[model samples]
Structure formats: structure tokens, C-alpha cells
Target: MSTSAPEDFAQALAQRLGGQSVRQLAAVSGWGRTTVSDIRAGRHIPSEAQLRDLLMSVGADESEIASWQERRSAIITPPAA
Candidate 1:
């Protein structure tokens, strides 16, 4: 994966969030707005558990959650030599 993978992941997540604001997502996910903002901005990449919690808080279906997990995995896992 390229260096921009995290940004791409964040952009896709933001799109999935649609019109929801960072504050609203934070309230629903029990996370601070700054955390949400950082995730959305690609300044922070949440752990698997944190990502699952955020996705579940937004009522993400299993397939959607899986897709996000795959994306997150792609970012964290390096390409095989």
C-alpha cells in the first residue's frame, strides 16, 4: 500500500458517515470530538476494537464493518515481499 492509504481510508469512512458531524458521531460513539476529528482527518488510526466500537455505535451492518476491517487491515499490514 502507498503512504496515502490512511488518508484514503479516512476519506472513505467520512463518506460512509454521510452528513453526520464529528460532534454527533463522537456523541453516539462515546468518543471525544477531537478523536473523531482526528480519525476523520487521518491524523489518527484507531485500533481494531476502537474501529469496531465506532462502527457499531453508528449501527453499521456486519458487511460494512467487515469492509472497514479489511481496509484497516490493509493499512496496518505491510505488503508481502
Candidate 2:
């Protein structure tokens, strides 16, 4: 697990996609390269729409998408902290 949920998501995505480049993925996702780059670099935490777009672009299954969403929620909301 990463210190941040965004990092965890980015790491998992990188591993899942193997050698695919972020630029290529961004092209496929119809999103800006910088957005993907920011996400992968842990410089940006995606909004819900962005998350859904990213997961769908990567062909992530329902469960994986849900898991990411849950992780995002947990991180953003925290536990009364």
C-alpha cells in the first residue's frame, strides 16, 4: 500500500499495464498527457469523474473500479480525522 490512495492507484495501474507508456495510455483515454502524468507521479488526486474515465480507459473491471473508488473515498473522507 502507498502512503496515499492516488499513489496506490497509479502504482497498480502501471503494474497492470506493463510496458505501456503513459502518453500512449493518455491518447487512448482521450485525456491530457499531463493529467495522466500527474496521476502517475502522485502530483494530483483525480476527481470522481476523472477516476471513472481513467479506469474505463484502462479496461478495468467493475470490482477494480469499485476498489479504487472505495480507496479514494476512504482517503478523502478519512475516519473522523
Q: Write one digit per residue (lDDT tens) for candidate 1, span 1-81.
A: 575888888888877776778888889888889998888787899888768768887789889898899999999999999
What digit string (tens of lDDT, one per residue) describes model 2 on residues 1-81?
336665776677567655657888688777789987887666787787777777777788888888888877876786774
TM-score for candidate 2: 0.75
Query: Which residue pairs collide, candidate 2?
Result: none
The lDDT per prediction is: 0.84, 0.74
Best-fitting candidate, scored by lDDT: 1
Task: Note each model's CA RMSD in angstroms.
Answer: 2.5, 2.7
- As for candidate 1, its clashing pairs are none
Tell me the spans in candidate 1 whose CA falls farther than 4 Å from its real position. Answer: 1-3
* Cα TM-score per model: 0.84, 0.75
lDDT of 2: 0.74
Lowest lDDT 10-residue stretch of candidate 2:
1-10
Number of the top-ranking candidate, with TM-score as the measure:
1
